[model samples]
Target: MLRLHRSALYYVRPLLRAALELTPSKSDTPVTFVPTVAGLLVRAQNENVAIEFTVEGAGSGAPISVPYGSLAKVEGRQHEPLELAATLEGNVFRWSEVGIPQVLSAPALEPAAWPSLPAQDCANDAELLTALREAAATTDIASLRYSLGCIRFRGDGGQLAATDGRQAILLSGFRFPWSGDVLARRCPVFTKLRLAATDERHVGRTEDWLVFRAPRWTLWLKIKHEARFPDVESQIPAREQADTTLSLAEADATFILQKLKHLPGGADQNEPITIDLNGSVAVRAKNDSSSVTELVLSSSERSGAQVRCCSDRRYLQRAVQLGFREILFRGTAAPLFCRDTRRAYVWALLSAEHCLKHNEQATRIASPRAATAVQWANSESNSGS
Candidate 1:
């Protein structure tokens, strides 16, 4: 059995909610809650990470038992009746679920093989979570095209990135706070995984898993390597090659996104929007009824610099959502680069057709940047040492 303070359960409870939904591929799996002397031991597949918490209280010495599959549905406290709840009341714990299997006793206990403590490679938790959340905001959920479903973390370059084949976000210097049975995680992990920023944190990697540890808790994530992450740096057109460097018009961009996001057409019927960069910016697209709608951006950096590209209208809105203060426009066919002034976070999106064609050609070239985003995150790993 395991014992934990009431507040502690409130904190880690959300994590149990984030475990991946079971699939035929089993790439996503739920956490296995095993009682341990340390506290509670939770494990995913070998490729995934587990979390352990230390419990202290008068009842800390007593054994605690949780059902094997109960981790996914834990809601530890509530004033009203709950179909299932593991509530904590003034150091006392009570649980009842309408339909779950009765867990009468703590399962067989065994020593768990834990990762080394005080991880060697580390980044501040708050900083890392900020970067990771930004990148994750743009990941694709409906399709499994390429590595679109996973966030790639580069430990060596200090980069984190995500793409849906149409648009991509790349951020540097983040420490990537990690998690879960993720009925959620695809986008929630970005904003969720609420570890305090004040705590000193470090993250390390074993053969195929990433370990993130804070003073109070630890999180591990599996390295997804079944598919290759495209070489993002090289795919982005070199700045020197851009014909027009423009500042993103936040107000105008937002107006355009709100209009097109609800356009009547289904995904299959969506049409590419064209951004005509001249003396100013003119964004043109169709509304739900296929009627042409145009918006102009007047504060462009350079006037009359002609360049044009047709891309997914929703992606343009997403670029604005990324909230880049400055943007760069290359040739009509190149992907658009929207980034912060500090160059800390970047988002790149090419038209669906162009994005696919670019990947085909990009595959023919070699990247000196790195093999994968996060299989190895340090310079030493690049040397194969």
Candidate 2:
């Protein structure tokens, strides 16, 4: 019997639970145990690495190896033949084992020719690289779709927009010079690009990978999720409404949002917050509990610009916290717009209901100075609602 440490036991429980949930109980699949499995071999491939494992018992036919990279964080003895206990979880095989040591083995990469990914020339590689990383972080993992002929590269580099219907993000500051109609192809390599320029310029290419480098660090990503992104070209509001240039101070936006964040159950979902631009800039928040709080945007130029729409306060807060010099809220229908003039690089759509809720809350919190700070604090305390 192998003695398990408290820490090790603690770590194994969740993994065992997950494996038990993922293993197939009804299927007859022979399990093949591979000894000397290299732990880090999966991490070192210049391109996406695929490994096949054969199961020894049960006869689900020959063992099929799926993408082992999708394993939820593997940990155990790396130098021992760690026995993987497989059980049935729904239609898949969940693996869990105890006290098995295995050495890491490098996967055999075949000498196969891979197509070249288009290379774009960027003046400042650092900025473009950073934007790619930030955009990648916002991607959804479960519903990711891949396309080989969907990669688009054009002269003058362009923006990359990705969304999964519920939420979307637009990243800009990409300037790459490539000739032709912006060829679109599937990226065949595992590419990593580090950003090192202040203006966001960087580029890199591996055997089958091309990296977009940035100023501070590099991003290693697999080129997946390349489907026809929705037609957002017509989503942007045309310049029609009387464009009001509102000067927003960073400190002021931060302070007001902080106050509005306190409303109970108000900011949850797409609850609209009201913005009263009459004499001074004001923001209001409310919840189902009938709790309301209002915050005033401390601005010097109060020309009275009023607009209301539904939005997720959390999204608005994140955009403001990113330090945009001026924020623009335009239009009232389907494809509402919110642009950060400071970065002038990213924009997002507003949620209609959230905008309306905030607007009403703002109206309620507007006049009373004595209750403003108190309400703000209480609202924050009960914000999870």
Candidate 3:
């Protein structure tokens, strides 16, 4: 019999669910519970990644494997703090809540038959998770450019880079122990698991796998070939190449973001929003039926030039979200560039033809100036009512 706090189980539930996500729906997933001196060790894996964590408590019995499908049906309240005892008898595994009469049972599998997992001895101190996540966000998962689906960690200066062809992010100053470059697929599990501050994070590499390890849990991602990835350093434009620069104030950024919240197609990050700089900064978003156009900041607020560019709304939003106050634009055909202290982002601006086509569509709707005022007035009126 094994007794453990429900809090411990709840703490590891996200990892379990993330493991489930790694496999296809039709597959019958088994979560192995190995009897360890510390407590119970839960392990799950798929083709792309594997995850396991030790839940420390009381345990004394043979290791048992339980199907996640059956376990999910009776996992009980997740947020409630309680104690539970589990026991494996013959082919069935059962767990009952302490102080409660309710007991749940699930079919069991032979623990010895479970596939062996890779050993983790992660001592690398590169702190690559944060950089990996930021670079991974720029990868193109659905594109045929397979190389763009992976993040490259350069051993030279510990630079992490990824691009979706449309956008790219580069993070420098990471210190990796590996002397050669490593290309790793941007797996969601790496970013999904939350690491506690108390837990010492480390990265490990074997012949075939790259491992991310913490105190109680570890995850491994398959390494990819770096031969296909493009030379990221050469792709970034030189500082002098920028022909126009817009330094937005905090208030200007906030107003633009607020207006975006009310715009159509908030769900589609790829939706185009044109930023026009003439005497004022005008932001516009339009769909088939409705359109939103507003002058977020006047030229008096900041110096302006006659330049216009269409960009992915999410790309722009991400720059603002990352506390980037200044963005550089070379021309409509050039990529937009922004950077913080350690990271730089390059967003490919939509072509002039694309912007023109969208503008023609917007012509069917009310003029930007009038439409924005009307929408703002209507919203205010509705709120007052």
Best by TM-score: 3
Better of 1 and 2 by lDDT: 1
Question: Candidate 2, residues 1-385: lDDT per residue as tens digits?
Answer: 0111223222332322322222345122221222222211111112332212111122222222222222232344332222222223211323244644332222222233323433553455344544544444334445545332233333343555544344445555555444322322322221232222344544434333444433322323333323444444355444344243345664465455565576555555665565545566666666776655666665423332456555556655655665544545454434333454212322354554455334332334332244364565466568843
Leading candidate by lDDT: 3
Ranking by TM-score: 3, 1, 2
CA error at residue 314 for candidate 1, angstroms: 2.8
Better of 2 and 3 by TM-score: 3
For residue 257, model 2's alpha carbon misses the true position, in angstroms, by 5.3
lDDT of 1 at 153: 71
Q: After superposing candidate 3 on the true structure, give the runs of residues whose Cα lies further than 4 Å from its correct spot.
A: 19-27, 78-91, 97-105, 110-128, 264-270, 288-292, 298-305, 354-385
- Note the residue pairs that clash in candidate 3: none
Off by over 4 Å in 1: 1-11, 22-47, 53-65, 68-76, 79-119, 138-148, 174-188, 224-227, 253-271, 287-290, 298-304, 340-385
Cα lDDT tens digits, model 3, 1-385, are 5555555665666667764463447335767777787777777765656677887665666666666664444444543333333443433434445656555555665543433344544343434566667787888867776588788877677678999887788888765556677887777655676666566777656766667777787776667754478776666676567777787766556545555655665555577777776555666666666655444453213243567777878888888876777788777777888866677888778766535222433432222243265565466457863
How much lDDT does each candidate structure score?
A: 0.50, 0.40, 0.64
Backbone clashes, each candidate:
15, 77, 0
